[model samples]
Target: MQRVMAMRLRLLQRPVRIVAQSNAAFSTKAPEFSDIVYGQDTGVRTVQFNRPEKLNALTLPMAMHLTQRLHKIEANKTVNAVVFSGNGGKAFCAGGDIRALADNGKDPATRHGEDYVADVPKSQALKGQGLGTYLALTGERLKGHEVIGLGLATHYLPTSEYETLVHYLTGLEFADHVPQEQRDEMIHEALEELETDEAFQEIDPEYLETVESVFGALNDNDTMEGIFERLEKLNTEWSQETLATLKKMSPLSLKVTLEQMRQGAVKTCAECFQMEYRMATRMMENPDFFEGVRSVVVDKDRNPKWSKRDITKVTAKEVEAFFKPLDKDQELILYPSATAVTEKEE
Candidate 1:
């Protein structure tokens, strides 16, 4: 626990920079759902996710549709804010569609995916040479600084879901290191903490019901007590209503929220929103995300063949690479008014 907090603090100590790029690719796709709800009230426009059968899982088309819709809404004068939600009430999104990614992984073109991941080691070696050949040639970037930049400024609300998943996966990578006895002890502690956690108390009982619907039956007995105890020690504070609202919100809103959170420091609420959009674009091509879905959702094999293979396989250089700004060719739409700029005047 001390280690996790220490790691988080170390990660947060970095500078934030907002570089404008092109938004040219945002309109490459079109929306396919008429079931999507649109609202321009309260200066906020919302686009809901609406697909619950597959747990609101996102497909490539769905991702493309979301990107394109966000572009349109950002350009519209009537909208000042946007909300994303899901229909059928199962999930906001379990994450990307793993089945699609697994299918894509099988394609001949995806051979590059493996080769490119292989080249990452070479890229790390290139660090000492002062010229990174891998990034220059592959158009790859670093995320450490970006995460550091984002974590310092991104409030829990917008980036919470994605970061929660990242934390879960990150912790999972270290699970083997923990002795069974310690694991059981931590689990017991977390379970006891759950009883006193009152965030659930304020949420609607019906919404609380939905959580059980997705996670499965809750227990009145001691069966799940250890699991609950372990979770409490981890100090995870999540609300079902907030999760429901996120699930029901529009893809456009979600993207924007994610990008803003990823891009800048979370000094203010407005700043976080601006960062969410940028972060989404970065993850659009990230391998961990796709791999995460494959392990947890698609294959059901419970093993994610991460691009890095192991978390330790992810070096400081590679994590640093994720924060690098996109190449000059990648366009970012600059909504000047959309930015949360509070830079002091010289």
Candidate 2:
């Protein structure tokens, strides 16, 4: 893990120049994406996850397709910003498809192996490391307000004003080199439309309180060991509920998730993706992950019989193994441009 982190730091030391290009020569037609809607009007490009029946549960192929589309968007100078939403008005995304992970009937080798797990989480972590760990481990769905409160989303809108927001975005026109304040003003006006809705206002406090309480508890400890220890000692109703929830999850996953979140704080987004690729590959070999998917997704039984029921029994050595690199061919390969710029550099 230290060697990988050192390698990442060395990679960042090298300088690369990015020359801005004009979009006039590029194609205007939106590229087709599987399980996604891609469209552009004026300067705004919108990407909508389109699997309503499954609550927009992202599959491996869907994630890869979306990633490819986003790369294309990055190179297109016509797009000012992107508006991401989900079809069916229920959820933006329900995270990965656990049922697909558990299903080994058609292609057993491809479905349940080091390769399968590495591929899925590698794509997800490239987008955001913290959210990937939380979603992959707990399978907890986030609604509009929760998503916004977590800083994963910039704006929140009620379902009623969804079309209005899209229309407003599509109507917007910007100069080739627009002022930041002008963009902010346009966004402020679009957000103002949702402020008038009583339902949207009502959800705000509840989600904010939820985020505060959970994060406050998490902040009480500096390390994952200390955090879990504090959690075990707490007597409050929320603490008890949280502990019960943790008990239900796979022990291996919980340990891996904690390490993922811990490393995410220090690692670049691209580095975190590489780390997740290694951790997830090892997780697939463990029986608990398959059992977790079987109980929650396949059978809908809500009872997963984990290999190690008690968190304390999950050895530190066991957790450490997940961080080791995979074979050269199996490792995640990140694009140089995907490396994030640190706040200090800005």
Candidate 3:
């Protein structure tokens, strides 16, 4: 166990941020629909999931709205950052509204204008929605400089969304090149979209290089097999705990912490510190955040007692309150120096 644990520790110690630098600008309001609110100022646009009646859970209109917004932001040079948050303080977003989705499926009115609505039978409406059902798919191609997803929605949302879009993009690429009738039979069809997309293809080389560099630094044998062994060891519970700690320890003061991380491989020490502090200040006051933590941790009641139990009841003042900094942050550590010696070396 110790040997296994030690290998895992060595492999997992390197800091790894899951998604790379494709940041999508968040649109606060659902432009196409009145119910959703969009916030755009400076370079950042926040698309607040406003339907509190449904825990800000998404609907088909919301998804279409998001897709259009992302496309608009990507086309605009002025906007560079975006965030996804919920209107009510309770959630960033509650995945998808299964009940609303089921209801929407039955209603032909809302389904009329959707992208895949024509291809799939009315009965299989929801299932035919494809990978775009999640948020990341709509935003992946636009590939903004920064994107931040607040609350529960941040989990696997971006990753799965990107993968799905990439897959379709690859498919479209193959479909474009081959005879229409023969396209489906391509042996490498699964990730063809991902493989061929200019944006996705661009991200892969960088990510592969990053992974290879990290693995090379950790593995003593420096062999292909050794790298796989290291990956295996580091995927255990201990590694996950270490990753969680790293996420918690991240410089929280920045306004767009997740966005900054996604943009590039490196940051100056000063830039990192400044952003961390800014983010921490922004996060200090979100009542929903506290409610969520309490529900999940302190109360153990499993149901969050929220500040604005209803999103419509939520006010701009309350959201503004979270942005107010309590005090000048104390002396803080700057970014990690690339030249700093690794613990493995020590």
TM-score of each: 0.32, 0.68, 0.26
> On residues 172-210, what C-alpha lDDT tens digit does candidate 2 reach at each position?
556656676666665564565444333243345653444
Distance from true position, residue 169, model 3, in Å? 31
Segments of candidate 1 deviating more than 4 angstroms: 1-32, 37-49, 57-89, 92-286, 309-313, 336-346
Candidate 2 accuracy as lDDT: 0.61
Root-mean-square deviation (CA) per prediction: 22.5, 12.5, 25.6
Which parts of model 3 are misplaced by more than 4 Å? 1-32, 104-346
Q: After superposition, how far is residue 139 of candidate 2 from its true place, in Å?
A: 5.7
Error of 3 at 248 (Å): 33
Expressed as tens digits, the lDDT of each residue in 43-135 for candidate 1 is 235566756887777765666556556767666543323446676755676665556655665554642222111111222222212112212
Report the Cα lDDT for candidate 3. 0.38
What is the overall TM-score of model 2 with all chains considered together?
0.68
Give the per-residue lDDT digits (tens) of candidate 3, residues 1-346.
Answer: 3433443343234221112213242223335566577765443455667788767767666776675567667655444345565766665666555454333434545322231211111112122121111111111222321121111111222333443433222222221234534433322232232222232222344433434442332336543234334445668663344334322321221112223332212444454444444433344333444454456545667665554433235354543443333344332344344533232100
Could you tell me which 10 consecutive residues in candidate 2 have the lowest summed lDDT?
13-22
- Model 2 sits at a Cα RMSD from the real structure of 12.5
The lDDT ranking, best first, is 2, 1, 3
